[model samples]
Target: MPDENFYLDNDDIRFNLTHMVDLESIAELKEDVGSPDCAYESADEVVETYLDLLEDPIGVLAAQRIAPRAADVDKEGCHYDNGTVTLPEPARLNVQDLAEADLMGMTLPTRYGGLNFPATLYTAATEMISRGDASLMNLFGLQGIAETINLFASDELKDKYLPGFCTGEHSGAMVLTEPDAGSDLTAVQTRAAYEEDHDHFHLTGTKRFITNGCGEVLLVLARSEDPEKYGGGRGLSLFLVEKDETVTVRRIEEKLGIHGSPTCEIYFNNSEGYLIGQRGRGLTRYVNWLMNAARLGVAAQAVGISEAAFAEARAYAQQREQFGQPLDRFPAVQEMLVRMRIDIEASRALMYATAETVDMEMLLSEKLERLDRKDPRYADLRARRDRFAKAAEVLTPLAKYYTSEKSISVTTDAVQVHGGNGYMKEYAVERLYRDARITSIYEGTSQIQIDRAIPRVMAGAFEALLDEYADRDYGTVALNGLREALAEARRSLQAAVAYVNDQKLADDQRDTDYRNLTARMVCDMALDTYLSYVFLEQARHSERKAAVAAKFIQDMAPRVEMNRQYVMSGDRSVLQQFDLLTGAQS
Candidate 1:
């Protein structure tokens, strides 16, 4: 069994918690000073105590307890007998350990038996959990389900569900995807009907590929409009349904990776459900809110998997010899190790930056809601909230798109670093590589993320944010040089966006197609420029980080220009020749 505490041993995570993130400020906002729900003397105390908890009981549990059992959990997998899904013994034990630590409701209000930590801290803990066992993080990370109910569900529902979720007595699933309605949720065929006599709604639909679908509480999306007046997504409503005699687990998928987390096909035959929030806003409001947070959680999972893969590969490289010298001494192997670590750090920086913005948004939202209409602070706070919301919108998809893609590269390199051994199941990288494959596909694919992010990139959303980062003083000549390189890349990106916009606006019939074709290059340049700023900001904290920033800026500046050049080409051959290239029937 590994005895090293995952949180304490990781210098990068330690750096983030101590310096990169303002946990103290977030704690001050999240915790009530007058009468604290958690045991704390002050905001500093809250920060201190929380970090301690993560190191000892929580991080220790993850590294010492969960990491040891992950192999067995993956091997035994989940068993579906008769209609119920049961976790393997190791997986069950992992859940039990987390529940014992009162970790199931990391983001809920303390009033509801939760710690009420900000999303920043909650996501940090999630990274550690995923590092321990990526499969287990699926079950553990669904705490966001309870948070969604708290946000949109009725008070009656919150009273009944929040306590159970916080106490680990109950677990839940978002329950959105269907066999026919995977990416396009508007195609959801599930039906929900109100039974006024019983004062409830009945949900009848099938949900496929649901993570932890066997959970006790399910927040389902169903079409609720009148047949004659259906309005696409507007016709959909969110429902809080429970697992009962009416709900059945039809089958569990077996294959690729994360086997400990069951991918379920579930059937709801008139299952009793209560309407959550107002009617006709399920996909537009509730599910959108749930999915944005879920995408962030997936990014955390990707970075955790990257961390694990790097550790495995680095350990092997140090010990294994190539021809007469240790593998790490070789330029080829050393380059792989260096790039893998830099990628992990860059992803972590982006993920935490996005999470911090979300945390601020949540805090300001609560304040804006409670303040009187005439209060002077209301307008200023609301403006800040709106800006944060926009930043969060761009950063969330960018984080998801980049983190998942980088994780795939990092894990693939782990396999390559091990030569043939990494391909064998005997190695941890083999499983980590398999596990990392699904992050890009689920929640939302990378293509889907690009489609969502491009409009914001084109809208010049990064202009103000980049300006704020640019104003910061780096305190060193080398760091200033990196900042200037990033600035040059930003200028190139702005020009590319202008060119694409000008071209698309000029064409009426093919504008949308043209935009779609160039979307990836636009988003790539935007992300490359944005991520360079992130690393430059990190350069202030450590000399080693400054070196990392130098290497990354040097590497990405030319790539950003290259991507911009591609967009400037006005390439329409892909669309014009689609029929010829594919030999399609006209």
Candidate 2:
């Protein structure tokens, strides 16, 4: 078994949750935060209860149960036997332990026999699981399925499926991608035909690259009506497809990494499925509901992988002797380790901030649903909930994009730190590197995440928030300098955005080029701002974190300015001379 000491302790999780981010204050505004009977049991208690669970021996169980199996699962992968897709032995054992521990439904509501954990807390657990073994995070991190059912499934559907899911009796798949409609879900060709006599939908389609596609239950996105009649997401409907004889797992793809989570090409031939939510709202509503949770899960998985990579590199650096000294004593090696540490921490800071904000809103919305229509305060709470929901919509994808991409960078560097040894199958960093590749690709690609974030960026939501961050009093004279440096980077991003808008593209290529340039500036500034705020919060506790934060701002501020300048001043060389760049063409 791997060293359990590397797993995230309860104190570290709490530190990230409570101090670096504003979990309790946000919770206080949320009515569904705590027990109704005791008003005195504030959000603080709610947070502590959550932390206490992290300290449980179950914490050790949750992290350890899956750790030992990661390697074998990766080696054996998933096997499709006849119609049934059999998971690798290690994968099977890992899922079984998760189910037995009731961790499969980590973020689902208690009403569905789940733990009713906050997204932040759930993400923290995900990080721990990922650290132990990145491959297992795919299986363990998909509590999104239960969350999806809780939000969209009717009482009948929820009653039938959620308990099984919560208890780990069932695993699930999001059956959205098809051969033609990988990224463009609006192009989904899977047909969900309504049966007038039976009043049930019969789904017939082939879905490719479906993650955990062989799971017991499937949330399928299918076209129910022609676009000429209903249209796009409006033509689409969500279905709860129980895996019976009608649905066949034709084959599980030989994946590049995270092989434990079965990625299957499924054939749904006249499969019976219950409609979830209203007709024509499946893609628009249910898919959105599912994807939001999934996006967050990806962020957690990324963090976990980072944790694993960091542990491997940090441990190796301390033990591995170089030039008659420990590698840590060497400047180049120390720099590599420092960068890896910062990368992980930066990703984590963004993940927790996003999760905390989103969970608070989820809690508020749950409370609002419980409030009577006649209650005087119901309207106010409902309005606040709506605002938080919108805020979460912007933040979730942003965090997912930032963290997953960071994991790719950090994990790759982790392997690099081990030099040639990292490339060998014997090293965990090699596995960690492969595992991290899937984080940005699935649950929507980094491109998709940015497409989601771009609207929020264009809307100037972060610009307004920047003002709020600027207004924060960094009381220490030394720290105030770093705050000013961050403010400058925020302005550079603003200038870059203005430049992009000023350059109206006539061609698709030019438009894409401009968007990519703009995206870099936006993401860079967002990360800088996020870290600046994280370190500012850290200053409230440790001087060490404050110093790290200060160094981060100083290093990042100039990079932000340079990126912004490239966006603003770099030639529209692509726009001005496309033919020149194309040369004789391929």
Candidate 3:
């Protein structure tokens, strides 16, 4: 109702395409990509085609068909009865439209009936779909499952399952969690034993908290090795199992948000399964790759939700009257609106930067796999590939962490802007509020992201990345003090990271507890600095963008110091006073 085309209506998405993203650089790396449908005359042609495709079909479909149905889809939700899962009509239609549009297997090879697009495009599409309906994104975003199959599965396995996936005749579920294993996937109790007679494995175990567990295809992580020898994640191997009598959904969870998404408990009993790759590499390799994709998808989803919530709040503020004037005229309300807008913009920048980095890593892997070792370009290209690989590993988690947390803040403020009516079902922001809550919890929580990112940051990889961006001509002298301020922030951040890395922070019982305790502060400072640079990159093209950059850097300056001070102060109150503060029995 508000905007018929989500992509067309958003100027930032377009600006990123035209300004921030260097499609030519990414396309040159993909010049010889052997996928059948990946044929491109030039990088320019690819960019043009991508923009056209987004405007006509992907943009229109998400705004018109999906967003319009989101309300009813959420209300109706999924119906679970007699071990059969049925999606609400509206939700089904939302998914069917994307299927018909041939968008389901966005990044898979064309030989598998896919579009063979880059992850940046896939991620951007994910954001658009999530903007339409968070529930639909759960279903639509399952493309990662298909891509994983294409990547790791044998040619025979790919031939059997992938065409169906790309055609949208089959959907998939990533089955990893168990009752005893939520975040610690190493504790998964699922069992998959090889049956000599059948020459395949038979899976038997329970998987809990699975999204889209009712889908036709399931990628399972199970223990295939002897626990006594290869315990924990080492014993795990990835498997593919289809929906059959032996594979059943026990029950779906009643969630606080994203109600249309079916979070299920599944029981696999003697279900015939095929290994994706080598044994004992499930958690270490295959699932890790899949989870990275899943985390990036969630980041895009968070940004989309933020966009929708901000739109609703912005519209309401302009139209609604309070104290004999429009609510937007009030200084208090205006500040919230501006802050929400800036935060949303910052998160979008972070997410896309991550997505573009993933694109480089993904395409580079494809190229290097086939390149001759003696080729002239091999050495230089391999170095480039490894560099992007390192950046992608860290950025993916940061994108997921920052965008998801920002969505919570943006959505909460949206409701606050709307007053009492925002809490009611009459408005879409109510559902958006619920949908935004899950982004930070799933696909690795914010804490998990910090644990993953800080080591890489301390290794000097992320800072080197920021410095690489610094090489791009600023087009001018970073608006005078903006450059100096960013330098100071970077200095403060480096000192804080050094303090966190110091050996003196160790405790008698646990050496790394201080690092764990003060991690969020270090990560927060890093994020603020990253956001400032991201905005400055945008600030190069337009006066409006320049203003946006200044606003972000100026606002986040104090935050950078606070986090630095807290980390540098060696604050261990959480660890030192755990029992005292929490009244623990022990």
Candidates' TM-scores? 0.97, 0.93, 0.97
Query: What ranges in model 3 sit over 4 Å off?
Result: 1-3, 31-38, 471-473, 477-480, 505-510
Candidate 3 residue lDDT tens string, 1-586: 6458988999988888778877777766655533465577677887787778788688999898888888998898889997898888998887788888888777887778887778888878988888989878899898999989998999998999999998889999999989998888999889999998988899999998999999999999999999999999999999999999999999998888887789999999999999999999999999999999999999989999999999999999999998899999999999999999999989988888888889888788778888899999999988988888998988888889999999999999999999999999999999999999999998888999888887787776668777865556667776555766788888898898777666462253434778777777777888888778888878888999999999999988999998888888866778888898898835
Ranked by TM-score, the better of candidates 1 and 2 is 1
lDDT of 1 by residue, 385-461 (tens): 99989999989988988999999999999999999999998899999999999999898899999888888988899
Per-residue accuracy of model 2 over 249-292 as CA lDDT, tens digit each: 89888877887888889999999988888899987788987888
Q: How high is the CA lDDT of each candidate model?
A: 0.88, 0.78, 0.87
Candidate 2 stretches greater than 4 Å from native: 1-12, 25-44, 372-383, 505-513, 575-586
Cα deviation at 368, candidate 3, in Å, is: 1.6
List of clashing residue pairs for candidate 2: none
User: What ordering of candidates by lDDT runs from best to worst?
Assistant: 1, 3, 2
Worst 10 contiguous positions by lDDT, candidate 2: 1-10
Error of 1 at 211 (Å): 0.8
